[model samples]
Target: MASPVSSPKKNTRNRKLCTPPNHSLFFLSLLVSMITFFGISVLSFMPISLQDSYLLPLLSPSSEPFSSPSFSSAENRSQVTLASLALTFLDSEENEPILSNSVMVPLPAHGIVGSNVSEEEREFWRQPDGEGYRPCLDFSIGYRKASVRITEEKRRFLTVAVSGGLNQQRNGIVDAVVIARILEAALVVPVLVVNQIWRDKGEFSEIFDVKHFKRTLQADVRVVSSLPSTHLRSRQTIETMQMPSDVSPLWIRSRFLRKLNGDGVSILKLQGLYSRLSKNLPSDLQKLRCKVAFHALRYAAPIRELGNRLARRMRIEGPYIALHLRLEKDVWVRTACRTGLGAEYDDIISKIRGSQPEYLRASQNMSYLQRRLAGQCPLNSLEMARLLKALGAPRSARVYRAGGEPFGGKQALQPLVAEFPNLVTKDNLARDGELSQYSNRSSALAAIDYIVSLSSTVFVPSHGGNMGIAMQGHRAYVGHRKYIKPNKRSMLPLLEDTTISNAEFSRAMRKLHAKSQGQPEMRTNKRDRDVLAYPVPECMCKHSVNNDVSHH
Candidate 1:
């Protein structure tokens, strides 16, 4: 009877399910529902392609969500990494000879020109049929093809011509020779003087092996280089020949020397060298189309292999950055500013730090302590003052803040490492125990790749002086936006050329605003929507370093 009475009240009205007193389930369900609703709404507004490509496929596997696109991939900018770039090497496909045309131009006769052939010279090419045309064209082409083969194979290698031009008392052709050795080329023939030096049985020979050349053909090749001559006769020889532009002999003559007609021995030596190289050259040389093309096929493989080996030994991996610190010589010594090398280090660090994400700048600068701790008698305070003063530092400022101090050689590096914790200064790349200096190509390139890997920004001081074309070409390949220095010879040109357009200017302004909360006003005078500009840095200005630092 009591059960019947309770059941009677349960019938009349339908009551909704009210949650229990705790209501934990109710709150959780409500939270889930709200999240779902918002997510669905957001998805609806997103691009249909994006939703189909990512979200919907991730969530429901089949549902089409976003139906429109108002965003672009380009606008969604992100930092480019070394892995992503993969070190692209553009080829000079145009330079490649199209075997399509067999109508080749005849090469000029060199030996018996003007019927002034001396008895010795005439005897050199004395032939049975009264010196029948020596097939100079065919010989030249064949030699070129052989050199091409060598270039192609070594495209993975550096074609370093060790002319007397690149050699010195302390830094011999050994640096370039060692680089060639490290690359493991199919052949390594020195150009002109460098070859002579390499072949010498002196102290350098004690350190290097002339026997390596025994597997060689007559290692003679005259390479026209971009250097001034000591003798008027040499200069006249240089002035007489027509310049050709392919990486072939003609190309070398055309591109490297301003004019041709140099010494016969030099030219013959060069041809001989090429012939020797050709004899030993592999088929891979034919594949090389550009200077950069060789880098991809040849140099990078060795560098990458070396880098990977280094990483494995050091317990690191793919994400490492290369740093080439040229502590040996002043790269900018005779040119623009006679500043110390320390400033270059500072410049390198600043550039590296700026482009790197906040997380990567974890390293520090330590040149100071290294200099202090090096075991020489501590410089008297006066000696220190003079050194600092010579380095263009204000005596009142701290030694660390003293800007533009030359690295007193590699001694400066000790302090640099202390300052930067994760800084790697390993230079053990040579199979041939040669130290890398600023002028060393292999070292420079290795350092380039390292720095590029570590940081997005790279700072190359200037193109003048010893900065080689190979290095410049490398930087350009890696997306380096170049900034040339403005010297005393050109101000109006600098100002005239610095202009930018309005659309670009506007976008830059907007980007700056989006990234910064309170930026100062632009100091530019041009208000035209289509015109804009940027200034060269103080370092590049002709008014002496820091003279008008405020402009920077």
Candidate 2:
């Protein structure tokens, strides 16, 4: 061998000569090393300016490297620096990339860090816009119209005595509104007669806001708490007229108007007033019914405040369900549900049934299955619990019981409470003396229930009652939130069939109520007995452009 250093030079020359003068391979290797060195240097510096440009282009065969004359300028240098920094950032540990240019980069889905540009773009579309999704009634928009005050050509007043349970009274009030419009009479706010069954002693003003009620109906109908002092003094001049049990709009226009024309003030003592959906009423009057029921019939401030406070306390991050469990003492007796309670409770049911109305006495003669099919029996606590479970209501679901005490109180609710520990009641949420003032007062208590039920995420009524029907209609008019109307008629056979598996029962229940959830349209034909229960096509307006405009 030659001298050590001379020997290495001789070997390198020999290897180069043996490679057949491959200039392409030699230059390619040198270019790659230079590019790698440049990337390392750029990343080390990480200049703030190089935060948004496309860095991968530098490695692309089609694009020239940073050796271009344009990149030598100060502005171009900044752009190069930005692009380098952005690449470095993308390589580093950051959630989103900071690219100088809108370069499409492949990214992973799922997690934030590994997620790509395409996923981020998709997420941008998924995010909720400002104001969010408001599916309910916008009270602000509802009250935007200028107040409408009716000018009665004839100076006549109509004073009506309202009678019935909480719901009956409510229906009567709605009917009274329509009647007042037809007769063109100044309405005297009807009294809320004490419910004989529940023994409710609450007055109209005690539960509802008297001032708000009068002010709201001022435009549609002249409503007053009492007759004017001038009219009161002229008692003899005031002709007391009792409305017939089956009085029609035509009858009122013809015979009724003739009698009131000569009178100083006609006090129309009204009774058994309920919505007559078949009658071809004025469209304005129909809307007025909605205004009277929803807008005008607001609860007293104190009751509303209490209801809101209770709802807030009960609600977690999400909305709560208001289950109007109509399994009160009166309901059990009226429906004769004692047959299933065995002989131990037979005497109790018998005594309770004795106190019920003559109509309910006939229910005692019918079998449990017959009563259930007829929709006469209210769903018991156990049945309600099973139904809720089958409906896939989460275990942690916040349930607010809207009605009075169940038939068996805490004992009866144990099964439901065990399954859904978050279940609460007005009494449970409220302190002992907080709602004591309105204790035993059914109407006032119902008002509290109404406020809470109205604000609920979901409303499930065990049976059709005044509060249930009103709440259903109210929710429908508002953004049509989830109102689960259980098919009690069909549910009876399934619930009674103990042979069925839990999974099968749940599947059947879900299928039975598939259409009942969300926004369901009520039958508009003559078959619809309770048109006031779902006054959507007539009462509600589409809140947004995206909503179905067919009903509007």
Candidate 3:
């Protein structure tokens, strides 16, 4: 009844409903319509598969797939959504393969693997309206990986050599093989420098020192140039042999070779020296003997080779000491060779071990001897002496009585050097620089000079070869400054085991020399006795000898 009266309020309400919308509402309606239109347009423009599989389900709850999550409550739905989105993006071939193959492309910049990716690939993923797919983890797994690349390169090319005093015993080649494989260096060739050559060449014969030929023949080898002072320091005699036109023993001296090539000097000097040195030499001296210094040489060959390589590759900027391990075989052989003799090798070894207390040390700390003798029983006196010396003990300490009496339990004369500082100090190197080779004689001399300048001490073998290089290159001073741990005097173990007796050593050396040279009438007199009998004598004359031999 009241509505039928047509009151002003009722009339206004009806007018309001009937009238067109105000400007605000009109604009709002236009905006809302435009938004809806655009939404529909975007949905239509999507890929057929995307629209059917993703956009439609997202916009319309009716089309949303039902997931029967097994958990009691859907607490991590947001996390699930994010994971789902990641999976969806990666599912596409165009996206997943991009990241996988990225590692194969050559790195644009030289940086560690953990740093920056290629710029083009990075930009490709930064789209404004894209279905956001940014990788959260740094992923690198392929040829570029450090492990893979190193292995591949190692399989390419390599050669290894094991030589004893310039290709002697040939056993060191074993170590070369072992270390080469461990470093992943692909070595295709293995060379053995036989120690037998030295014996055949005679102790002091010209051809006995075949180091030059061996060293020049191949570049890849672990060569030992360490021999007795008698051999190394002795005046070198020469023998002539057929040579290639461009190659000559005279070329041993780098400076001389360059000068001769430059001035076209005749190689008559080398020919003359060779003829004089080789004249009337024994058949054994005509060829190199690989026995006398082979043990130490073979063992150290790899390390020396590695040292040279490291010097070249890493540009080492310091002096390096090549500490030879002559204590074991040398000591045992000497000790066992002279049983009742006053200068028994075992007694000497015992004295040497006593001088260097480390000889008596147990295998607790990780010294070379400890590592080698771990879980093994105690070593003999010679073995102990060798171990002590190898651990870098002082060599000046006394190992024998003044009047040739046996100091049975004397402490090591040398100080232990296991933890000695400055073993490889930069200050120790000579300011004179690297070795040069020109004439064979000069080159040999230069090599000696280089060794002397580089090393503070030269550990020589008892018989010979050490003297050859030492005397020629001024390295003889180095040997004199240090004690010579005689090889023949040390105790020797059984054939399979490393034990020794003084008497056994003398017999072994005599037999080794005779058997090696095929000379049944060969005899070593007081020279051998003097070498095997006494500790390396200190130089008394003022020959400018350096006597600053530190324990370490």
Model 3: weakest 10-residue lDDT segment is 101-110
Better of 1 and 3 by TM-score: 1
Candidate 2 structure, TM-score to reference: 0.68
lDDT per residue as tens, model 1, 518-549? 11112133332100011111001112121111
Relative to the true structure, candidate 3 has a C-alpha RMSD (angstroms) of 30.7
**Which one wins on lDDT?**
2
For candidate 3, the per-residue lDDT at 256 reads 32
Compute each candidate's TM-score over C-alphas: 0.27, 0.68, 0.20
Q: CA shift at 272, candidate 3, in angstroms?
A: 9.5
| Candidate 1: Cα lDDT at 139 | 18
Candidate 2 vs candidate 3: the TM-score winner is 2
How does residue 203 of candidate 2 score in lDDT? 73
